[model samples]
Target: MKLSQSQSFVRFWAASTTSYFGTYITSLSLQVLIVANLQGGAADVGWMNASRWLPYVVLGLVAGVMIDRAQRKYVLVLTDLGRGILMALIGLTDLFGTLQMGWLMVMMMGFGILSIFHDAAYQSFVPQLVPKDMLTRANARLEQSAAVAESSGPALAGGLVAWVGAPFTVLVNAAAYGMSGAWMASIQHASKVEAPAGSVRTQVKEGLRWVYRHPYLRSLALNTHAWFFFHSMTGAVLVTFALVELGFNESKVGFALAAAGIGAVAGSFLSTMVGQRLGVGLAMTFSRILYVPALFLIAVAPSVDSFHSPVFPMFVVMSGQFLYGFAMGVEGPLEMGYRQTVTPLSLQGRMNATMRSINRSMIVIGAPLGGLIADTFGFRTSLTLAVAGLAFCAIWFWLSPMRHAKLDENQIEGV
Candidate 1:
């Protein structure tokens, strides 16, 4: 069946899309709040960002076990509600003038904890909602929503922050999460996976063993871990570089970042076609190779001091961001579908969690490391390092087992 005609899929899509919109808004607004309102610096931003991903590293294995043993839909709804309340409380603290950097870090940490479960359950739940054949299309549709959110959320947040304030902007995010929970609750389907009889540690070990034993998955996991590490390093200092070195106001920064979203939307539209034409493995390889040059373009963009007007440099940055986002868009669905197809239903949550944990663990290291590099050396130097690291990742993927595997072959047999 076409994804558009599936009612449960539609409901899931709506809830996910709504949450993504709010999440993107919070991503920018929170940073702006820290840097502009609270007098925090690059190091502070890095720590806060690291706090958000820390749960994935800390609780990922346990969460995977729990998710596999429970009803995923309830996990989804409850986590969304929990996140909504947390965000609301944070906004209230800001309203009463009691907000502090330490408090913000704590709340972001809470958000990350809930996010770990929500993300693992949500990824595992998708296969239950759609036919295996339609996984690519379904993933593409979901990514399109994300692309839309990414495209508009930052620009909206920039304007909102400029008009009202950063604290108040978070209230909108809270509302979105609340509504997302309600939408998820309205879905008629319930996850039907029977809880496997095993200790949590045993289940976790099985998941890890499966991934480590599979050559294709193992290579993909390693490549992605490096990819996220280098990417996070660049991202950790990107806002600081724009605001300080490029001399950009919040609105211009938002506009510059929005270019990526636009490119993502276009890539989402083309992903399925590209996958069909080039084969998923080759498509992923090419897109990742292209990402290296895009990062180079951003790293080499002229700073504000290099020119009287910042427009030219900003354009260069935006162009690079656009390409980066586009590559992610094209690769996201293909990669996700391949993983989903290969994994058994019983191990879905654990597989996703293990992979996601490895990917996010990089943020814990990269965020602060990036911030420290930028603080000690400079943004350009840090970015140059990121470029080199990402180039190595691309080369690694090119030489791995995944580069020669065909996505259409029998799932594990191809590996």
Candidate 2:
């Protein structure tokens, strides 16, 4: 539990958390800023958002394999530096009155590439730093910190946008990424990734083959990917629904989101205690059930009322977000621990990337579809579909061995 034991990881984690905080700020601020400033439509918004993650969909698996071969610390540092420079240049353009939609989109795409290496390398590095028994707790701590950062990031960005301006938020983000890069460069442990013994394609295939062939991994990926796809679809439309349809102010959504973050923080702490008591598989399955009810609760919320009768949708969104965030917190550490425990240290980067690639692909597919549905059937109907997708995903786990799951102690032993 004590970070002092891993001085390098502590430094790295602290800086990374701050970097995460900045990333969200840029994300929320840019969407609101561009939409407000550009006189743009839904497509513009969609493209702006897509540009940030599209690179990952294209580069994830390849990046993972590359990270497995490269020095992880260098990858992390280089990516952070790239983002920092990009942000600084962005800030300069705003000052020069040369900022445009095209410029912003290109910036997004470039930074997206940098983030690929950053994320792929970091996930791979964690297992190398911690003991097998500590992986869950380590991931939990990191996830908890991230949840806390995300909870505050949007509001901070929104507030800055409201007060001083939107463009300046990029400056803040640039500074954070710079600091993060410096911290990453200070890591003492060299990565333990093994050089591939064969052709690049063959080695990459080996990584993918191992992950998909494992029964637990296959079941876990299906359910997890489904959960994320639907969640992203709903998330893509939530702000539009809450603010546009329900007439709640922007600040109100921020408050509800912040409250849910508090719940996420609780869940991160609870995960270790719960998982240890219930056994990992049983605990993961139980957490999966929580999500179904939560999604249902969210889909059915009524708009805020005249009687101020608790503003059903507002409270519902808040409660559902809390549960969803909590479940995600619980699920993440469980999955990461299980995956890392079973995967060889050398292939960690590739395995992590392969899983991340599938997850990102789901989002890439879901976002535009959600945008279309919201544009056509309406946000409420789109939300209903999203909830249905999530409910249907539950079946993925049920028919498989995952439902009555058991994470045997034997799985942790290395060959």
TM-score of each: 0.98, 0.91
Give candidate 1's error at residue 280 in angstroms: 1.1
Tens-place lDDT per residue, model 2, 265-377, is 87888888878888777778767777777767666767776436546667877898788778777777777887888888888888888888778678777876776788787
After best superposition, candidate 2 residue 134: deviation in angstroms?
A: 0.9
Q: Which ten residues in a row have the lowest lDDT in candidate 1?
A: 405-414
lDDT of 1 at 143: 92
Clashing pairs in 2: none
What are the lDDT figures for the candidates, one per model?
Answer: 0.89, 0.76
Off by over 4 Å in 2: 41-43, 89-98, 304-313, 404-407, 412-415
Q: Which candidate is the best by lDDT?
A: 1
